[model samples]
Target: MEYVEHRMNDEAVKAAASAGLVSPLNILLLSIILYTGYSTFFAKTSYPQLPKPPPPVVFKTYNPHTLLPFNGENGAPIFFAVRGVVFDVTPGRNFYGPGGPYANFAGRDATRGLACGSFDESMLTKDLDGPLDTLADLGPDEMDALRGWEERFTEKYNIIGKFVSMKDFEELGKKE
Candidate 1:
């Protein structure tokens, strides 16, 4: 009986000693380490990953009849009517030189080349010559047709210049 009581007392003493040895300072140190680690990682500021969209495209256009050497009947002109306006396009070429580089007439944007042009800009520039070709006898309708096409074109492209038509061409010769 006494031996059993002594063994139990010894076990109780060992348990008490182990429980008492739980140092508050050690517990505080462990808590601080855990808090610092959590704050440094999970509690800190974070940013989300997102995708970026591509830049917008710009369009370009040219007026017909401002250019030279316009086509006649290798094919007739292709006339376009839109928004109460009329336009005629005759296929041909005009010599570009000096300040007007071939690439610029092609709408290459000089610095950026073909890549700089929009889908419409690039498409329109295909086989297009210069202000001379663009202006060459595209067609003549009522002045209102010119106005509508001009308005539609201006919506897409910047109108850099105007055409000196065949009438002006004859007038120039008469003047000089």
Candidate 2:
């Protein structure tokens, strides 16, 4: 009786194996486990290392003429002046660079333009060497508008330098 029962169990096992009891999913999982174990403990592959970044550039003061070259022309960085503060607006190149809507203000004092909410060339200072705009004619509302723009610039861009007149810059150089 015992021999008959053992023979029946052996036949059942052979039938199950022939009928594809081990699924395709089980085979795939086993292959993945083997690959993972081999890669983790036996593979000699190494990942490539990334290069380090360059150092930060030192900021320099700029007068209007000196600042003119940084208007996104000839691959130059974009910079602009606002109320005597020179901001490096390179990150906003899309809006302040060449062919941009506010490109006219790049490398120039944008005080009056921003205060008046105009992007016209007429708003910029006509003479680079001339005295800065006093903004004396601006009403309270205009002044408030200018202040808002200045605040946004301060929050968004780097204050690379101060915008001074040529005369003031020369005086500063002489003092140094």
* Candidate topping TM-score: 2
Worst 10 residues of 1 by lDDT: 107-116
What does candidate 2's lDDT look like per residue over 31-77, in tens digits?
99999999999999978988887447567778989988889988799
* Local accuracy of candidate 1 as per-residue lDDT tens digits, 1-176: 99999999999999988876687977888899999999998995768968786344322122333332222223323232222122232121121221222312331221112122222334233432332223233434433454554565546443333333345445666888
| Native-referenced Cα lDDT, model 1 | 0.39
List the global CA lDDT of all models.
Answer: 0.39, 0.91
Candidate 2 local lDDT, residue 141: 100
Off by over 4 Å in 1: 1-5, 45-176
So what's the TM-score on candidate 2? 0.72
How many clashes in each structure?
13, 0
Best by lDDT: 2
